[model samples]
Every structure is written in structure tokens, then in C-alpha cells.
Target: MFAVAAAAGQTVRNAAQRQLTQTLGTVGATHVRFLFGFPFAVVFLALVVAWTGTPPPRPPAGFWPWVASGALTQIVATALMLAAMGERSFLVVIAYTKTEPVQVALFGLVVLGDAVTLPMAAAILVATAGVVLMSLRPGQTASRPGETAGGGARPMLLGLGSAALFALSAVGYRGAIISLPTDFVTAASTTLCVALAIQSVLLSGWLALRDPPVLIAVLRAWRPSLLAGFMGALASQLWFLAFALTAAANVRTVALVEVLFAQGVSRFAFGQRSTARELLGIALIVAGVVLLLWVH
Candidate 1:
């Protein structure tokens, strides 16, 4: 349930961020998620602490590196994703990001020592294949006409890079959350607050130093940016909660449903119709998600 809500919230947040990218550019738009989301994250942490009657856990010596990795990689991933969104349809961009589950499984193994069962591994492969099929569907190239025949390659590469970075970010966040010696709710909330704080400072400082105008633009567009931030923080909170309960691979593999949410946004909101191949890809993704859940 948390994963489903997170996916839906994330889909809306992505749409909001994508719109901001047009005016603020990718970095500024990415910053909006962290900067504006920080307040909400603080509120969430306070609520968790209040409810639990426990103070936030102090980080161990190793905690900073894990949370910092999560924060930095997430900022990079959001920037890459927004850049890709500028070049591709929302559904296509998100479909490409759906490839993160496989990468998440790999990263989780290496970074957190989280092991994937054989069935989960098979499900990840199936879902990954669906994402690739959706991304490479025959008519996908029609949108890019200005450059040479290889014009489509740039967005594809950006999407894949975004997927890899997002996967790493997920692993890092999960690692940070689990490292905390607290209840799941408190741990997830505290980790979220710290990570968002780090991201907010890092991105805001960079924007201040390098591109003041874009930061001003983000502030000028505060209404939508705030909405995006709220949704982004809400989604992250739920995602962290889910991560506390399961392996990063499980959380991310189930997140493949975000692609389906993106499809709905494309069809109803943008009047785009799915091709037969895209429909098949969606089915495969659904099947993989169901298998993963059953095995879990």
C-alpha cells in the first residue's frame, strides 16, 4: 500500500517537476523537490517523534556517508530524469526509469549486501525486459526529428543513466535507513529528514553559486514548485517507510508500477494512446510485479 501510494505521488510530482523544468531548467527544478520538500520532511519527522515519544536517533560514525550518498545521487538522478523528460514523452521517460529495479538489485547486493532470491531475480529480469521493450518500441523515435537518425540515442542514454543513478540512490537510502537503531517509522522519518536536509543544502548552494536566476525563477514559481515539493516529500516518506520493511530491490521492483501510472497520465492527460507493443509491455511489467509480490 505504501509503495502504491508512493508511486502515485511520485507520478504527480514528476509531472510537476517536468513543468518546472521548462522555466527553471533541470537543476533548479530538481532543487525545488529538495528545497521545498524540506519543510514537509521536518514536519514528518516531528510527527514521528511526537507519536513515538522518542527522540530522533543520533547517527553513527558511518551514517553520514550513506545518507550523503543517497542525497547526492538522488539529486543527480532527478536532474538526469528531468533532462530526459525535456526530450521525451512522460510515459517514455518513466518507462526508461522503470529499469531501476534491476540496477537497484545489483546495487543493493554490492552496497548493502541485500540478497535477491531466484524468484525475485527472475521477476526483476522480466520487468526490466518490459521496460526496455516499452522504451524501444518502434514508434518511439518519431518525436526526435531535428538531429540525425541517431537523435533518439541521447534521451535514451540519459534515461538509462537516470535509472542507474536512481537505483544507487535507492540503495543508499535503504542502507541509511537500516543502519539507524530505531523503530521503522522513526528510522525512516529520521533518515528522510537528514537526507532531504543534505540535498536541500547541496542543491541550493550550487544554484546560488552557479545560477542565481534559476533559483529566483523557482521561487517565483513557488505555487507549483511547492506542490511538487509536497508530493515529492510525501512520496519519499512513504518510500522510506517501505524500504524500512523490505529490501531495496523489493521496494524498487514494485515501483515498476510507476510506469503504468505514467501511462495513465499520458493517455488521459495528454491524449496519447498506447500501441499494442506498449500494452504488452505494461502487461509484462504487471506480471513481474505480481510474481515479485507472491515470492515476497
Candidate 2:
């Protein structure tokens, strides 16, 4: 249930992000989203603490380092994802980002000594195959300027890179959660708010010095940006709660449903027409994910 809620939150956040793609370049949009979201994050943490009659746990000496590292990775990942959204179809980008689960599992097994079952390995292969099918591009010349080469390769690369960094963040956060005495969800979520605050302060200071015009635009565009920020922060809280309850592998595999969510967004929001092949690809991906979960 938590997993489902997390996925829904993420899907909504993606939709919100998709709307931001055209107005701000990927980096600018992310900057706005994070910047606007920072204050709400603090409010959210306070609300959670107040409602629960609990305070956020004091971090251990090493906890801040882990949280900062995790946050940095996420910042990079979000920036990369924004770049991908600017250059590619929403459906394609979502499909590619789903690769995070497989990447995270590998990272866990290889780096963190988490065991990987054969079934999990098979599931990873199945998911990879789905990604391959989805990424196939028809004949397009690379020499043509402004033409998308190999369909969505460049965007896919950016998306994949983002996914990888996001996976790293996930693992790092999971490890860091052990240092806190409060609810892991609260701890993780609070860490996110703190990290975002750091990012917002640093970026705001940089922008104030370097580019006042864009900063002014962000100030003027506070209405929508605030909505986006609130949603983004709320989504992060939900995701942190879910992560606290479930394994990252489970959470991520279920989150792959974002591809279906993306499909809906594409069909309705952008009038993106899908071919028979795409529909089939979606079905296969869904089935494979279901099988993977069932096996576990």
C-alpha cells in the first residue's frame, strides 16, 4: 500500500515536472522546483513532527555526511532527468528511468553485499529487454542537425544517468537511516528537507550574484512554482515513508508503474498517439514486472 501511494506521488510529481519542461529549461525548472519546495519541506517536517508528537532524531556524527552525499546525488539526478524531459517523449523517459531498480539492485549486490537471487537477475534481464524494445528508433540520419538520432538516445542517456545517480542516493539514504533514533521515514524525510535547504541557499546565493534576471523570473513565477514545490516535497515525504516500510527493490519495481502513468500523461496531456508496438511493449513490461514481483 505504501508502495502504491509512493508510486502515485511520483507519477503526479512527474506530471507536474512535465508541465514545467517547456517554461524553464531542464536545469532552470529543477532549480525552481527545488527552490520553491524548500520552505514547504520545513513546514511539512514540522507538521509531521507536531501531529505525531515526536521530534526529528538527532543525527550521529557521520549521518550528516551520508545525507549530504545522498542529496547531492539526487540533485544531479533530478537535473539529468530534467534534461531528458526537455529532449524526449515523456513515455520514453519514464521507461528509461525505470532502469533504476535494476541498477539499484546491482549496486546493492555488488557494493553493499546484498544478496541477489536468480529470479531477481532474470527479472532484471526482462526489464532490460523491455527498455531495449522501447528505445528502438527507425531510420534517422545522425548527420542531420536538430534531428533526434536513434530516436531518443541522447535523452535516454541522460535519463539513465539520472537513474543511476538516483539509485546511489537510495542506497546511501538507506544506509544512513540506521543512525537516527526516530522513525526512519521521518529521519529520511527530514534529511531531504535539510539537503534541499542547503541546495536552495547555495543556488539562491549563486543566482543572486550571477543572473538576477532568472532569479527575478523565479520570484515572479512563484505561484505555479510553489505548487510544483509543494507537490514535489509532499511526494518526497510519501516516498520516504514508503522506503521506510519496504525494501528499495520492491519499492522501485512497483514504481516502474510510472511508465503506465507516463503513457496516460502522453495520451492525454500531449496527445501523443501510440502505435500497436508501443501498446504491446507496455503490456510486456507490465507482465514482466508482475512476474518479477510474484516470484519474490
Candidate 3:
């Protein structure tokens, strides 16, 4: 449930951020998610604490390292994603990142000792293959037949690098949550607030020092930025909760629904027509999600 809801909200958030990339550019748009979302994260934390009547827990020696790693990597990941969208269609860029589930599984196992059962591993591969297909455009090839084509090698690299960074971030956040020794709601909410705080400050500092105009533009576009920020914060809150409940692998694999969501968006919002291959890719994604849910 958490993964599903996160996927839905995230699809909207990604759309907003990607569109803002046109006006704000990559760096400026990337800052929107963190800088604006931080306030919402704080509110979420406040609400969580008030409802539960529990103060935020004291972080252990290891907590900051984990959360900070997540925060920093996520900042880079969002930048890479927006840059990749510049290379290809938004849906294809999104599909490329679906590969994160496999990396997340490996990272979670090694970093946090989260076991990946065979069924879950199969689901990851199946869903990832579907995404690989979703990324293709007919008659576009890279030196050979049956190969995935990109705008260039650079865009492919950007998408893949984004996937790796996102995977690492997911593992880091989960590691932080596990180290907390608190209930899922409090742990997830508190961790989100801190992670956003770190990302917000760091990104704001970079913009202020190196790209003041972009920073100012981000502020000027406050209305749209605020929507992006709220949707991003809501999606992340749900993602953190999902991370607390199970392996990051499970959450991301199921989050493949975002691909289907993107398909709908591309069709309706952008008036893009889908090819047969892309439709099949969407089906495989659904089937993979169903299989994962069934086995688990």
C-alpha cells in the first residue's frame, strides 16, 4: 500500500520537476525538491510527533552517516534524472531508473543485511526487463540490432548512474530507519525530516555560492516549486514508510507502477501515442508486480 501510494505521488512529482527543468534548468530544478520540500518534511515530523506524543529519538552514532549518505546521493540522483529527461522522452528516462530495484536489492543485502529471497530476485529481473523494453524506440539503435538505443551514450550513462545513486540512497535511508529503534511512523518521519534538512542546506549553499541566479529563479517560481515540493515530500514520506516495512528491493520493484503511471501521463498529458512494444512493456510491469505481491 505504501509503495503503491508513493509511486502515484512520485509520478506527479517527477512530472512537475521535469517540466520545471525547462524553465529553471537542471541544477535549479533539482534544488526545488529539497529546498521546498524541507519545510513540508518538518511539518510532517511535527504532525507525527504531536499525534503520537513522542519526541524524536536521539540518533545513535551510526544514524547520521546513513541518513546523510542517503540525502547527498538523492540530491545527485534527482539532478541526473532531470538531465536524462533532456536526452530522451520522460517515460523512457523513468523506465531506465526502474533498474534501481536490482541495485537496491544488492545494496540492502550488503549494507543492511536485508535478505533477498529467490522469488523477490526474480521479480526484480522481470520488472527490470520490462523497463528495459519500455525504454526503446523503434528504429533507434546503438551499432546493432536488438540493442537499447539512447539519445547517446552519455544519456544512457546518466540514466544508469542515476539508478545507482538512487539505489544507494534507498539503502542508506533504510539503514538509518533500522538504526533508529523506533516505530515505523516516527522513524520514517523523523528520518525524512533530517534527510531533507541535510539536502536542503547543502543544495541551497551550492546554489547560493555558485549559481545565485538559478537560486533566485527557484524562489521566483515559488508557486510551482511549492507544488513540486509538497508532492515530493508526500511521496517521500510514503517511500520512507515503505522502506521501514520491508526491504528496499521490494518497495522499488513494486514501485514499477510508476512506469505505467508515466505511460498514462505521456499518453494523456503529453498526447504521445504508445507503440505496441511499449504497451507490452507496461503489461510485463503489471505482471511482475502481481507476481511479487502474490509470492509475498
Candidate 4:
């Protein structure tokens, strides 16, 4: 039940982020989400400590390195995902995110020496092929508004880069958890809160130096940004809890349902039309994820 709620929250968060994308550029929008979200997370963590009557545990000697790596990767992933919002289809971005499970599995096999069954390998190949096929500009289908063949390359690249970073982050977090204590939820949450703060500050500083106009736009749209941040913080809290309770694969696989949830949001909330090709891509992604889970 908690997992389902977390999944739903994530979908809502994505919708909020999509709204932010229109008013602010991707990086700028993400910066606002994190900047506003950091304080909420800090308070949430503090509340958890108070309620539990325990101080957050100190992580093991090497946990900081893993936590740092995870944080950096997650920050990059967030930026890339926000950038991808302007691309061909939100469906495309979702499809690419679905690809992350396969990538993480591959990384696990290589880096962590995790076992990969033949069925899982086949599924990975099939899923990769499907993503490539879907990514190709359609020759037969008529182009939709704000979409054209090959126009979404930049966003696609950004999305894939985000997925890669997410995979790295997953691995790092897994390592950190193993090295840390079992009751380290507080520590994990606190670490992530700090990491998000750092990422937001760095992104804000850079944007301020390089693109002050975007920052100005963000300020003007502060209300929406703050709301988005609240949603993001809530979603992140659930995700962190899920990560602490389950393996990354299980959590991410369940989270992939966010794509379907996004589809609903696009249709109803955003009043956007989704094409058959996009629907087909969604099915393919779900199938791939199912296959990945079989191996797990």
C-alpha cells in the first residue's frame, strides 16, 4: 500500500514538474524544485528524529563516498529529466526512464557481479531495440504539434544521460545501505536531504552566473515552483523510504508505473493527446520491465 501511494505521488510530482517545464527552462525549474524542497525535507527529517526519539545514525567509514556519488548522479539525473520535458513526447521520456532498469541490471552484473539469467538478457536486448525503434522519427505517421522527426535529439540525449546517472545513483545507494546500520533510515534521509540542498545551491549559483533571466522567470513563478517543490519533497520522502525498505530494482520497477500515471495526467490534466505509437511504446516498456523482474 505504501509502495502504491509512493508510485502515485511520483506521478503527481512528474505532472507538477511538467507544469514547471512550461514556465521555466528544465534546469532552472529543477533548481527551484530542489531549492524549495530542501527545507521541507530538512524539517521532515528532523520531525522523524524527534518522533522516534533517536538521533540519526552515523554511517560507516566509507558510506559518505557512496552517498556523495549517489547524490551527484541523482542531481544530474533530475536536471536531465527536466530538460527532456521539451522533447518529442512525455511518453518518450517515460519510455527512456523505463529503460533504466535494464541499464541498472547490466551495471549490476558488471560492477557488482550480480547474476543475470538468459531470459533477462533477452529482455534487455528486446527492450533496447524497442526504445531505439520508438526513438526513430516516424516516416508514416503525421507529425503532431511541437513534434518533428529528429528534433527531440537533445532532449533524448538528456533523458538517457539522466537514466545513466540514476543507475549509478542506485548502485551507490545500495552500497551505502550495506555498509551502514539497519536503523539508518534517518541517516539515509538526512544524507539525501543534504545532497539535494547542495545540488540546488550549485545549480542556482551556476544559473545565476550564466543565465540570470531564467532565474528571474523562476522568481516570478515562485508560487507554482513552491507547490512543485512541495510535491517533489513529498515524493522524494516516499521514494527514500521505499529505497530503505526494498532493493533498488523492486522500487524502481514499481515506480515505472509512473509512466502510465503520467499518461493519464497528460490526457486529463494537461489535455494533451497521446498517439498510438506512444501507447505502443508504453506497452513495450512495461513488457521489458516485467522481463527484467523475472531475472531478479
Best TM-score goes to which candidate? 3
**Local distance difference test, candidate 2:** 0.71
Model 2, 96-209: lDDT tens digits are 776888887877676556566787667655655665466554554443356465434777688789889988887666656655778765786677687778778777787789
Q: How many clashing residue pairs, candidate 1?
A: 0
lDDT of 3 at 31: 82
Best by lDDT: 3
Name the lDDT value of residue 63 in candidate 2.
78
TM-scores for the candidates: 0.89, 0.82, 0.91, 0.75
Q: Model 2: runs farther than 4 Å from truth?
A: 18-21, 79-98, 143-160, 269-271
RMSD of 3: 3.0
Worst 10 residues of 3 by lDDT: 141-150
TM-score comparison, 2 vs 3, better candidate = 3
Candidate 3 global lDDT: 0.87
Give model 2's clash tally: 0
Residue-by-residue lDDT tens digits, candidate 1, 109-144? 988888888999999989777776776635434555
lDDT of 2 at 250: 54
| Regions of model 4 farther than 4 Å from truth | 1-3, 78-97, 112-137, 140-159, 182-184, 216-220, 270-296
| Cα TM-score of candidate 4 | 0.75
